[model samples]
Target: MTAPTQERYRILALDDQRETVLSLQRALRPRGFDTEPYTDAARALDALASQPDSYDAALFDVVLPDVSGIDVLRRAKRIAPDLPVVMLTGDERAKTAVQALHAGAFGYLTKSTDDVDSIAHTLAQAARQRLLQRRAAQLERSLERVYGFEHMIGQSAAMRRVFDAVTKVAESDFGVLVRGESGTGKELVARAIHERSARASGPFVALNCAALPEALVDSELFGHERGAFTGAVGAREGAFERANGGTLFLDEIGDIPPAVQLRLLRVLQEREVVRVGGGAPRPVDVRVIAATHVDLERAVSDGRFRQDLYYRLNVVHIDLPPLRDRLDDVPLLVAHFVAKHADRSGHSPPTFSPAAIEALCSYDWPGNVRELENVVQRLLALVPGDEIRPEHLPSRVVGASSGRLRAVVVPEPQPVVDDLAWTDGMPFAEARRLVQERFERAYVTRLLDQVDGNIAEAARRAGMDRSNFRRVMIRAGVTADKPRRA
Candidate 1:
C-alpha cells in the first residue's frame, strides 16, 4: 500500500530586496517548500493579520523601509502566537540577534554567512518546529473534545440519552446519582455534570466510600476536630467543607455504613454539616454527585443502604450503559485507548487485524471500558508485531468467541437410536467425511438462521476476514442459501 503524503509547509518570506527574496525562493523551493515572497514588509504584515493560518513559518529581513522586522514580528505574534518566525539580517551585530531572539524569533540568520544550505537548514528546522507545534495544538484540542463536558465517549443511542440527561441536570442544583457497573466511568459522568454546572469553577472533591474504613467514613465526609479520633492529628476539613461552593463526588455511596449514610442525608437536606465530635453545625454550599455500581434500590430494600439517602442522591439520575450493550462503539473505544496509551508510552500503537477486532467485539466486556483500555495498554507493551492478529489477543478474549457463537456452532451429529449400522457398513474415512459434511451444512444453516440470513454477522461471528469468510461459505456451498443484507 502507498504511504499517505504529508502536506508541504508554506514559508512567508518578507524582504525589501528583490534579489534577496529570489535567493530565498530558489533555496527553499528545491527543498519542497512553498515560498510566498513579499518586497513590502507592510503588505506582509497585513497578510499576517488577515491570513495568519495560511503560512506555517515566516522569514523576515531585519531592515525594511516601511517597517522594522522587529515591529512586524511583534504585530505578527499578537495576531498568531504560534507562527514560527525566523529573522534574516545583513548586519552581523550580536545585539541585533539578541533583540530578534527577545522578540520571539525562532532563529536568527545573518545574510553574510548564510549560504543556501545554511539558510535552508535553519528554515527547515523552523518549519519542522512549526509542524510539531501545530500537531501538539491539534492533539490538545482533540483531547478537550474527548475529555470535555461530554467526556464520556460514546456515539450509541444509550450514551446519547445519558448525555442529554446530564445536560439537563447540570443547570439545576439537585443532587446527582450516577449508576453504572464498575469500570463504566461513573466518575467521568459525575465530573462532566460538575464541569457543566454553575459550580464548575469550584473545587471538585472525590471520596470513595468503599475505600475508607468504616471508622473513617464519617470523619472523611464531614471533617473532624483535632481530637475527634485517634488519627485526627489536626483540625481537618472533610470533602464536604473542602468542596464548598463546588462539587463533592461520593463514589460507592451504597457501601457507606448506615451511620455515615444518615449524616450524609442530613447534609444533603440541610446544606450544613457538623464536624465529627463538634457541636456547632457549619453551613456548606456544596453540590453532591454520588456514584455506585450496586443497585441502590436493592441495597435499600435489603437494609444495607438508607432509603432517604438514596432518594436524595437520586434526584437527578444518570444510568450508564455497560460496554457489551454498546458493542458498536467498541472500535472507536479501542482506537481511543490505543492512542491514549501510545501517547503515554511514546510508542506507535499496533493495528488490529479483522480477526483480532472480531475477537474483541465478540467478547462480552465484563469489566467494561476500563478492561478494554487495560488490554490495549498490554497489547502496545507486549506485541512486537506491527499488526495484531487473533493470536496476539488474550486467551480469554479469543476463547469468548466460542461461547458467543455457541448457538450457531455445529455440535457432533448423533447416531440413530441403538445403532451404528451405517458405520458398520461404510469405510472409516468415508464415514468420517460424511459426518464432517453434515456438520458443515448444519453449522452454516444455523449461523445464517441466527443472523436472519445476513452473511456479514455470520462471517463476523466466525472470526474470519469478510472476503475469506465468503470463500469459506462458497466452499461449504452455503453462500447461495444466505440472503444478503439490503
Candidate 2:
C-alpha cells in the first residue's frame, strides 16, 4: 500500500477515557502519526463531518460517553464513505467485533491486548490502506482532466479523427494547415500537435493574420533590420526568427497580404528568413502550422490567397468539425466548461438540469466550443441557485433549439386522481397497475417536456443510461419529438 506523505499522517482518535486517548497518542506519535485526541465523541464526529477528507483514518473506542462507537462509525461512513475507520475497545467480545466490522470498520482491536507492538501495527496498516485508496482516487480525478489531448475535451468520432491525424502529423516537421470555423479551437489543435512533436521543448509563437494590419504582415513574418520602417527603432526578430527551432502558428493565414505570402512561402521552402531591409539571410529550423477559416482553394482561384503558399501549408490538412456536427460531445464539453469555470471562480460546480443540458445539446453552436464556454461562464456568474434549470438558461439558447421561443407552460393544479375513476368492485392488482401507469405517464411526460423532448437529457437527469431511459419511456408509452437527432 502507498504510504502517506513524509509528514506525519493526521489521525482523528476518540475515546471516552482521557488516559486511554493520551496513551493512544503517545504510542502512535512516536511512530510518525500526528494524532488529534478527543475525549468527547461528539467533537470528533463534528470534525469528521465538517472536513470529511482531512483525516487519513479515524480511531474510536467501541464504548463512548457521547455516542456508541458503532453509531459514530456509521455516521462517519455517511459523511465520508471512503474514510477508513478502525474500532478500538477494552471489551474483546466476538459480538462487538462482528458489529464493528459489519458497520464498515476497517479493523477491530482490543486495547487490553498484551502486545503493544500489535496495536500500533494494526492501526498503521489501516491508515496506510486509507492513504493508498485516497491516492488512487486522486489519480483517477487527474486522469479525468485529460480527454483527447491537453485541454481539448471531446470523444466524438469527428474529434477522434482529428486526434488520429494529429498523432500521425506530430511526428514530422512538415507544414500543416488546420481548417475550421472561428472559435473551433484551431490554435489549441496546433498547440496539441506541437506538444506531441520533437520540438515540444521549443517555443510556440502564434500571430493572427486577420488581427494584424496589412503593413505589419511582412515585418511580422520576417525579422526587420534597424530603421527598416517607421516603427523599427531597433533590429527585431520576426515570428520566424523568434520561433527558431520551434513552431510558428499563423492563424487566419488566408488573410495574409499577397507580398507577405511570398516571403512566408520562401521561408517554408528554403527553411530560412531574410530580415526586411537586411541583405543577410538567417536560416530558421522552425515548423509552420497555419490555420484559416476561409476557403483557401476558393481564395486561390479568386486570385486572393496565393496558390503556391496554400499548397505549401496544406502538406497535412486537419479539419476541425464544428460543434453542430459533433453535438454528442456537448455533454462532455459542458462538464469540462463547468468545472473549469467553477475552479477559477472558487465555487463548487453547480448542477445542470436535464432540461438545461438538452437546450445546450439541441442548439446549433454556430460559435462552436468557444461560444459554449462563454455561455457556461455567463451562467456560472448570473445563475442564482446551485442547479441550472431550463428556466435559468438564456432565452436565446431555448429559442435557437427550435428556432422559436418555448416556455414551460404549467397547467392549473388539479386532483391527482381526477382523470381516473375507480369502481367499487375493481380488483386490487388491476387498480394498482392502473395507478402505476398513470404515475409513469405523468412523470415521464413532465420530464420530457421540461427538456424540450431531448431524451438523452431526460435520461441523464433520471440518473440512468440512455438505453435504459429509452426503455422506460417506451414502457410508459411516451413519445417525444426532439428538435435535434441524438
Candidate 3:
C-alpha cells in the first residue's frame, strides 16, 4: 500500500536584513516548512495582499529601507487578520517590543537573543493554529454541500415533505424505506442521507435486489465461506460486510426472494450475519437503507412480500413524488444534468430554447428523474446547435402537440361525426360536450403513454391527484399493462 503524504507548512519571511531572513529560513527548513525569504518589505506586502492566507506565518524584521516591517505587518494583518506575524528587532528595548506586541504581532523576538530553538517552537505552534482554522473552514464547506436544500430541486408540497423527511432521518441510524417509481431518484436521496450522517467517513455499499439472480442473492448480501459453492473458490465478503461501520443501501428491496428476506430480517434483528457455509455468525454494525419502486405494504397485504420484513425496513418512509407531479423542477433538473454531462464530456454547455423547456415541462415524464436525465443527455449528444429547440427534442414530444391538434380538427370516424351532429349550427352544448370528451380521452391517453401507463403517475400528470386520476381512468376505460403510457 502507498504511504499517505505528510502535510507541509508554508512560511514567509520579510526583512531588509538578508542574514536574519536566511537564518530563519534555515531554521524552519529543518522542521519541514516551505519557506520563502524576501529582503524587500514592499514586495512581501504586495505578495501577501495578492493572496491572503497564502502563508501560515511571517517573520518580519523591525527595520527596512523602503517600508517599515511594522507597516508590512499591519497590512498583512489587514489582508489575513489571523495570520501570525513575529516581529524581529536588533534593539532589545522593552518599549519597542511592547509596541510590536500591541500592534498585532504574534511574537516579538530580538535578533541578538540568538534563540533559534525558541523561535522555531513559537512558529510551529502558530502553524498548528492556522492549520486548525483551515480544516474548520473546509469542514463547513463540505457540510453545506452535503446538506444544502438546493441539492434537491422541487417546489411541490409532496416534494417538500420528502425534503423534511430526509432532514429528520439524516440524524438517525434507523432503516429508511424510499418508495417511488423507477426514475424518481431514490438512490440520490439514499446517498444524501449517508453523506449527511455521522458515518459519512465510512464506505457506502449499494446493491440492486431486483437485478441480482435469485440463487446468488443470499451470498451476495451475506458473505460466504471458502468453498461454500462451486464459484466460491476463496473466502469472500458481501455488501453487508463491506459496509460495516457505514451504510448498506438495498435497492429494489421488494424483489428479494423469501429465503433472502428471512436472512435479511435476521441480520436486522440480531445485528449479526451468518455467511453461507460458515460455522459462526459474525457481528456487523451497518445502517440499513432500502428502496423499492413497489409498494411494500400493498405487496405484504397481497402475499407477494413478507410483512415482518416490510415493517422492519419501513422505520422511516420517504415517498418520492414522480416527475409529472413536480413539473416545475424540470428546468432546474435540465440545467443540472446538462452541466454534469458537459463537464464529463469536455463539451461546452448547451442552452435550452424556451420552447424546448416548455415542451419538457408540459409533457409527462413517465420514467421520472431518470428519464429526464436520459433525455437531457440525448439532446446534448444529438442536437448539433448550441441551443436546443423544440424540434431538437425526441419525436415523442414534438409529435404530442401536433397529434392533439390534428385529433381535434378532424373527426376519426363517421359514427363519431354523426353523434356530434356535424350539421352547421349544431346545438352549442352538444358540440362542447363532444369536444370535452374527445379532449379528455386524447389527453389522458397521451399522458398515460408518456408515463408508460403508470396510472398513479398518469393521474399526477393529469393534475387530478392520484385517487381522482384512478377514478377518471375507470371512467375512460384505461388499463395499466397496455404500454400506452410507456
Candidate 4:
C-alpha cells in the first residue's frame, strides 16, 4: 500500500552546529516538513519577526553561541502569540528544562534521549494544542453575541422549528424549560435564549443540578454565611446571587430534592432568597431557564415532584428532537463537525464519501448530536486521507439498520404476580392497600437513588413524614447513608 500524504509543516530550526541543522532538514523532509535552518540566534529571531505566520512551529537549541534559545522563544511568542516553540538541549540538566518550560516553551526535549520521530510528534502536538486554544477563544467570544437561526447548524424541519421557537421565546422574559434526551444540546438552547434575550449584557450562569450532591444543593442554589455549615471558611455567593440581574440555567432540574424544590418555589414566587444561615432576604432579579431529560409530567403525577413548581418553571417549554428523528440533517451536521474538528486540530477538513455519509445517517445515534461530533473528531485525528470512506467508519455504524428513533428510556414497571393481583375474595380496602404499598416501595427506592440515598430529602420532596418515609424505605430495601439533620 502507498503511504498516506502527510500534512506539510514549515519550521524554523536553530542550532549552533551547521551539520546538526542540515541533518534535521533531511530527516524531517520524509516526514512532510520543510525547515529554515539557522546557526545564529539573532538571524533566526529576525526571520521570525519578519514573517511570523510563515512557520507552523519553531525549534531552537537551548544554549546558542551568541544568545540563549529562551530569548528567541520569547521573541517568537511576542511576534505570533499562537506560534508553538519547542526547546532542544544537548545537556541533561533538569534546571535548564524547567527554565525553558517556565519561559513558555511549547515543549522541552533532551537531544540524547529523544529521537527524530519523538521530536516530530511533540511539534505536531504543540501545533494542535495552540490551534485548539485559538478555537476555544473564538467560540467564547461568539457565545456572547445574539443567537438566531444560525445558532446551530441544521436544515431539517425539526431543527427549523427549534430555531423559530427560540426566536419567539427570546422576545419575552418568561421562564423557559428545555426538555430533551441527554446529548441533545439542552444547554445550547438555554444559551441561545439567554444571548438573544434582553439580559444578554448580564451574566449567563449554568449549573448541572444532577452533578451536585443533595447536601450541597442548598448551598449551591442559595448563598451561605461563613459559619453556615462544615467547611464554610468564608461567605460565598450562590448561583442565584451570582446570577442576579442576569440568567441562571439549572440543568437536570428533575434531580433537585423536594426540600430544595420547595425553597426554589419560594424564590421564584417571592423574587428573593434567604441565605442558608440566618440572614435577611435579599431580592434577586434572575431569570431562570431549566433543562431536564426526565418525564416531569409523570413525576408530578407520581408526587415525586411538586405540582406548583412544575407550573412555574414550565411557563415556556421547548422540546429538542433527537438526531435520529432528523436524519435529513446528518450530512449537514457531519460537514460542520468536520470543519470544526479539523480547524481545532490544525488540519484541512477531509471530505466524507457518500457511502460513509450513508452509514453515518443509517446508525441510530443513541447519544444524539454530541456522539456524532465525537465520532467525527476521532476520524479527523486518526483517518489518514483526503476522503473518508465507508471502510473508515466504525464497525457499529456500518451495516447497522438505522431503524426508527430508539424508544425513550424509562424505568420498567414491576412484574405483578398472582398474589399481587386483585381477586374477587379480596376486599376493596385490602386491594387498595396492597397496590399502594407496592407503589410506595418502588417510588421511594427510585427517589432515594435520585437524591443519592438521602432518605430525609427524598421524604421531604415526596411530602411524606420522616418516620413514615423511613418505614417505606425499609420495605423498599433502600438505605440512607446520611444522618438526618436536626
Candidate 5:
C-alpha cells in the first residue's frame, strides 16, 4: 500500500470475472486486507485517480473487459507513481510476464489462491516500502534535509549500554520498560526500538500517561464509545487498538492510577481490549514499551505501583544515564543541537568555543538533554557572533564549571521574585517567558516536595484541579517525589 490509513491494508483489484474479485476479497480479508474490486477497468482507473491514497497496492488481471491489463497498469502508474501493482493472468507466455514487469507491475500472479497467498506474504512489506519512498521524496522536495541520528546522539560507555540493550530488546516482541529522568530521551529510545523491530513497518503510537487527567486516562488508553462521556460524540479506537500490529509507547507509566494499571494488565494478558463506554473486545497485536521518570522499585514497595503489572511491563529494563553522568557526549550533542536549531530558523549555526563547551559539560543538567538543547537554542538566539565563548554560556553553566551551583533551568541563581538574571541580548518577551516558566517549575516542584510527592494533595494546595495541575507538572517535567497510590 502506498499509504496505509491505519491498521488494515487496502488493495484495488481489477478482474472482469466478478467471482474472481469476490474470491480475492474473501481470501485476502483474513490476512488483514481490504479489497475494492472493479470489473470495469475505466471505473477502477477513475477510483484510483480520485482516491489515490486509499489503496496500498493494486491487482489487475492481464485481460480486462474494455482495456488490456498492461494499458491499465501504465495508467495506474501514471496516477500513483509509487503504487505497487501486481498483474494477474493464467498466461504462461514469457513475453507478457516480462512486459508487465517492465511496465512497472509489482509481480505477475496466476488467478489461483496459491499465487494470491504468495503475494499476500509481501503485501505489507511492499506497502511500507512504497510509503517510505514517497515520504523521502516529499522531504527532499520540501526541507532539503536528510535525517541524522534518528533522534539519539550518544557514544559514552553508559549510553553504549543503553544502545546495546535497545538492540537486544528490538529483536523480540517482549514488553520493555525504560527508566530515565525526564528529557533523557526515553521516547527516542522507544522509537528506536520500534523502528528497529519487526513491527517497524507498522504504526508507533505514544501516549503520555501523566499529561492527561485522571478522569480520561482510562478512556484514552481503552478508547470510548459514542455517548461514553460528556465530550464523546463518536466511537474511537484506544491506544491499544490504534497500535495494532505495532508498538505502543506509554510514557510516565508510573503515574497511571492503580485501577487503570490493572485494566492495562488485563489488556496485555488477554491480547484485546474493550472500549470504555461500549465495544466488543477487539484483538490487538501491539508490543508495549513503557517508560517512567520515577523510581518504580520504591513505588512498588510503597504500594504506589502494582507489583504484578510492574513485572509484566518490566520484561526488559533499560536505564538511560542522565546528561551529567555522560559528559563525554556533550560536545557531540552540542554540535548536533546547534545544527538542528540553526536549521530550524535558517541561521548559519556557529561553533562553541572550547571553554564554552567545557562549561556546558561541567553543568549538572537536571533536565537532561532536553535542558541542554534549550540552553543551546537560547545561546544561538542571544549570541550574535560566529563563535560562542564561555561568557555566552548561561551563568549556571559557568558557575557550575567554577564549583558554584545555581538554579538549574533559568539564568537566575535562585527562584526569587526580587532577583532576576537576564541572558545577554535576550528580548523582553523572551526574558518574561523564561522567568514565568522558571517560576512555574519551581512552584510545582516545591509544592510536590512539600506534600511529600502526594500529587492529589499538591493539586489541592495549588487551588487547581488535579487535571490542570498535572498538566503543569508534566510541562515542567516534575513528577511526584513519591508515586501516588490508589
Candidate 6:
C-alpha cells in the first residue's frame, strides 16, 4: 500500500527576541512543519528574496534592530506576493496592527497571553492559505506547460469566463463535467482541477471507456478478484479503488456498457465498489469526474443508454469552447507551442511572420488545439529558417486560407451499423450494428477531441440535455477518459 501524503509547511520566523523565535519554532515544529528561526531580520529578508518559493509563510516580530518587521514584510511581498506574512508585536495599539496589515502583513498578533493560541492558529491558517496559492500557481505553470492558460486559453471574454470557472471550481470537491469539442483540452481542465483541489497530492487516475473492449471495461474500472476471469492472475484494485481519496476521471463515459453503467451508478450512490469476484464491497472515497463525447440524451431517447446515472454525475458542468470559437487565442497558443517544442528540440525558437500568423488564424481548426500543436511541430521540423512564413505551414492550412478548402458543418448523425462493409463480409446485421456503434463512438470521440475531451460539451453537441447525456454515456459503454497506458 502507498503511504499517506503529508502536507508540509515551511515557515521563516524572524524576531529580535531569540527566546520568542525559539518558542514559536518549537510550537510550530510539532505540527509537521519545518521552521527556520532567525534573530536577525536582515538575514531573513535576504534569504526570502533569494528563494521566495522555499517558504510557505514568514512570521516577524514588530521591531528589530537591523530592520523593522514591516520592512521585512514589504520585501517578502515583493519577492512572493502570495506568501503569507504575519507580524508579532508586544504593542497593544490597534493602529500599529492596522499599519502592519496595511503594509501587507496577512495578520498582526501581539505577543500576549491570549495571543499564543491565536498566533498558532493564525499561523496554521496562513500556512493553509499559502499552500492553496502555491497550488494555484503550480497549476498555472502546468497548464502553460501542457496547452497554455493552464489548459483553458483565451483572451476573449467568453474564454476568460471559462478560466474563471476553472479557478472557482479548483478549490472545491464538486465533480466537474467539462463540455467542449475535440482538441479543446478537456483533460487539461481535469488536471488543473485535480491540481487545485484538496486531492492534488493524490493520484489522478483516468480511463476512456470507449477505447477499451467491452469485456475488459468492468475489470479495468473495478478490479477483478483473482480467478474471477480468465485473465485474472491476482487480486487488484480498480480505478475507483486506486483513486480513493483522489479523483477518478472517466473520459468518454458515454461509451460504458449497460451492465457497467449499473455498477458505476451503484458505486457513485453508495461510495463503494465490489470487485468482480469479491463478495464484499470496499469503501472508496473517490471524487467521480466523468466526461463524454456522445449525445447521451439522444442515446437515451434511442434506447441505447441509461437515464438514471445522468443526474448523478452532472453536479458541476464546465463548458469548454472549441478552438474555432476562440480564434483570438491562436496567436498565443502558437507562440506557446512553438516555444515548447523548441525547448525540447534544443533549437533556437522560431518566430512567426505576420503572414504565418494570419494563415493560422484564418484556417478552420477541425482538430482544435491538438491539431494546432501537431501543425506547430510539423512546421518546426520542416522549416529551417528562423522565421516561419506562410510557406512553412502545412499546404492544407495555406490552401484553406486561399478558399481551396471550404469549411463544412457535418450534422451530428447516429452511427450507421452497416457502414463497415468494405473490409469484411461479416453478416449485414452484425456489420450494421457495429457500424452504428462505431458511428456513435466516433461521433462521441470526435466531440471529445473537438472539446479536447471535455464530456459535457460533447453531450450538448450530440443534443443530449445536460442531465440525460451523462446517463446515456454511462450505458453506451462510454468512459470519461482513455485509460492510462501501462
Among these predictions, the greatest TM-score belongs to 4
Judge candidate 6 against the unseen true structure and give its global Cα lDDT, from 0 to 1: 0.74
What are the TM-scores, per candidate, against the unseen true structure?
A: 0.59, 0.58, 0.54, 0.66, 0.54, 0.53
Give the winner by lDDT: 1 or 5: 5
> Clash totals for all models, in order?
0, 0, 7, 1, 3, 44
lDDT of 5 by residue, 12-59 (tens): 989999998888888878777888988999999999999987788898
lDDT per residue for candidate 4 within 1-486, as digits (tens), equals 111245567889999999988888888777766788999888888898899877888889988877878887887788888888999888788898888888889889988533888787877776556555555554433322212143576666788799989889988998999999999889889888988899999999999999999999999999899999999998889999999999999999999999999999999999999988869999999999999999999999999999999999999999999998987677666756765566565565577764566677778899999999999999988888688887988888885834322211112144333355433467889767756765665676578667765757888999999898877655443333432344
Question: Would you list the rank order by TM-score, best first?
Answer: 4, 1, 2, 5, 3, 6
- RMSD of each candidate relative to the true structure: 15.1, 16.9, 21.1, 22.4, 23.1, 23.1
Q: Clashing residue pairs in candidate 1, if any? A: none
What value of lDDT does candidate 3 attain over all alpha carbons? 0.75
Q: Rate the local accuracy (lDDT) of all candidates.
A: 0.77, 0.79, 0.75, 0.79, 0.80, 0.74
Clashes of 4: 1
Worst ten-residue run, lDDT, model 1? Answer: 405-414
After TM-score superposition, what is the CA distance of residue 102 in candidate 6 from its true location, in Å?
56
Quote the positional error of residue 134 for candidate 2 in Å. Answer: 14
Instruction: Give lDDT: candidate 2, residue 186.
Output: 98
Candidate 4 Cα errors over 4 Å, as ranges: 1-52, 64-68, 71-81, 98-151, 343-351, 380-387, 391-395, 402-486
